[model samples]
Target: MSERTPFRWHIAVFLAPAVVIYTLVMIIPLFATLDLSLYSATETGTKFVGLENFRTLFGDAHWAEQFWNAFWNNVWFFLINMAVQNPVGIALAALLSLPRLRFAALYRSAIFVPTILSFVIVGFVWKLILSPIWGIAPSMLAAIGLRHLFEPWLGQETTALTTVALISVWQFIGIPMMLIYAALLSIPEEVIEAAEVDGITGMAQFWKIKLPLILPSIGIISILTFVGNFNAFDLIYVAQGALAGPDFSTDILGTFMYRTFFGFQLQLGDPNMGATIASVMFFIILIGVCLYLFGIQRRLRRYQF
Candidate 1:
């Protein structure tokens, strides 16, 4: 019998650093937060409360109102990104990927530049531009004779969340565009040639061939968008404050968690409650990812090509 080769311990050795770092930064913190959520600080000391915090979040009137409002707001935020940003990104990617497109590199770079900008800067700049008193948006609208359509979008409750969501979309559209663009470019030239020979060309080729192949990438982008939307705090906080106002109309879980953890305005900090919120967020993201993996991803048949 031939001698069996020694197990490749080198693979484990090579992966050890990454595994250690991820454990230290991600896994440890996650479990710690979960642990923290089970305790509450009292006058004496921290005491285990089990699921009391969760009950308070769901059953307490004020807490439940804020939580549901933020939850629905977050869902709307993700939906807006999914509806507007991804389709726009895909369309832009398709146009850029066309044969003999002029100045393609410049167009791509120009469109992607906003993605690298700091959230603070983007929020501040957009705030200035949308300021009702002296913003350029009003001026530009007036110049086009459509000034009547211009409202104080960021200031009004009805429009604040949508305005901020669109701003986020503007800042991040490049991500899905680049991801989808790469997916498009990775399609085998042989596949294109074969399709053309079968009289599948142009839009038909993209719809029947390229689009199917890129469904996996689109799915990835959707999950990412979902997670990012739920985790969103910076822009909302920067633009709308920790209360996520126009009367908390823009409040999402991230901002809610931040205010709870850090103590905003007159409210005192409650680390345990904050951790509970964080745990809820963790579970929400986990459930979304699991559904995508087990339900959606399995059904998406990836072609060998």
Candidate 2:
């Protein structure tokens, strides 16, 4: 009889490279960051300070104020995306999924174009377009006879964070749209036809049958948006700079961490403090993910389509 092959080793060999790479890049840095957060810098040199860094982050009034400001700003940023992005994406996906729609392929491609472009390009373009002095925003508003409504949105403290959040929603809406479109497409034609025969047509068909079936996709997208918004940085950084300025009104957790790690302007860099902030962010993401996986996702009944 031929010798039996080593099944476990074969599987391990294939997975080895991926596991190694993941550990080297993601896992190692995460643990390293956690370790760094426990230490503190002193005039004598780096020394163990246990939870002192975290205490400074949350207990010290000077640091706590900035921390909370960024935290709330991040929360607002996330809420805007949840309110605007997901629903708009679902609507677009539904429209695009309709049978016999003219130029459906073209429409999908056009709608998704912004998603493929780098955040840098989108940020810079919007920055100029929203610029009060030379931007097309004022001229466009003038053409529409609404010039009085145009403002330097990116430069104003009251509107800066919200404005950037909207900009991000515009760029990334295609992701949810595409995910939902695929989920919609996965639905069996026979099921829909059967519903049609039962007097479920058009709006009723969508609201009753289609929407319920797609809840899982929507849930996944919601969680993704939550994580993405909490981790947001590039668009805000590129458009508003490291200062996240107009007096830091636009600062979110990602920018907060960046500014802490590398330092900006008068602030000196402190890796230990930066790591504590990062660890806090990591825990926030972890908790959010756990809530979705255990709390929300468990309640969403998956229908076999």
Candidate 3:
């Protein structure tokens, strides 16, 4: 019998490229951003300001208000996805996984089609579709005799965030749908047959038997949704522009950070402040991930079957 090597060259060789790429792309840039947050631009040059920037972000009168607004908006964004997107995905997954369902593959494929499209495309397509003048939304509402409800949703502060959230949900719900579908499919036929024989059919079977087994998957989806929503920017940026306007009603941390970094119409770009915001966002995401790992994932039991 041959003894296993204490160290494997092949493993190291295979891991080297990914490790190098990650260092360059993710780790280095993250540390660089953190480093940038410690310094401030001066009239002549730049100088280290330590935690002064952070204090300004969290305590300064003007900065604090905007920061709080963006933070609360982000929370609202995440909550909306949890409320509508996850449940809808779970329901769609269940429907797709049903036995003897006709055109199941076609349905699944069609449902997932939106998920693979670029956020830019989705943003433009939805923006145009919802436009009041050149678009079909107002006309569609008129056709349904609900033209009173056909006001430009994206142009209104009260409805803009919710409309954007629903659009985001529609675009990405397929991810959770596919994930939950895979999890549902992993259940053994024998276990399902046993449940059926015991008279646990329909909703009872789903709630009692299937739901328990898929708790881990659901937990994963919840955390993933949370993290993704918190970090999301592209669709919002494309749809609403960097200002995320209608009186900044839809502004979240990502857009807030971008506006700070790149300068909007009247505001001058502030890299130090932008970096601080990015660092804060990083911490927020880290806290959420840590909570999922320690608080949520540990409690979610996976069934052997």
Q: Pick the candidate with the highest TM-score.
A: 2
Instruction: Put down candidate 1 lDDT per residue, 41-155, tens digits, no spaces.
Output: 9999999999999999999999999999999999999899999999999999999999799999999999999999999999999999999877599889989999899999999
User: How high is each candidate's TM-score?
Assistant: 0.93, 0.95, 0.94
The order by descending TM-score is 2, 3, 1
Better by lDDT, candidate 3 or 2: 2
lDDT of 2 by residue, 16-66 (tens): 999999999999999999999999988998999999999999999989999
Over 4 Å off in model 1, which ranges? 1-17
> What clash pairs does model 3 have?
none
lDDT per residue (tens digit) for residues 153-183 in model 3:
8999999998999999999999999999999
On TM-score, the stronger of 2 and 3 is 2
Each model's C-alpha lDDT?
A: 0.94, 0.94, 0.92
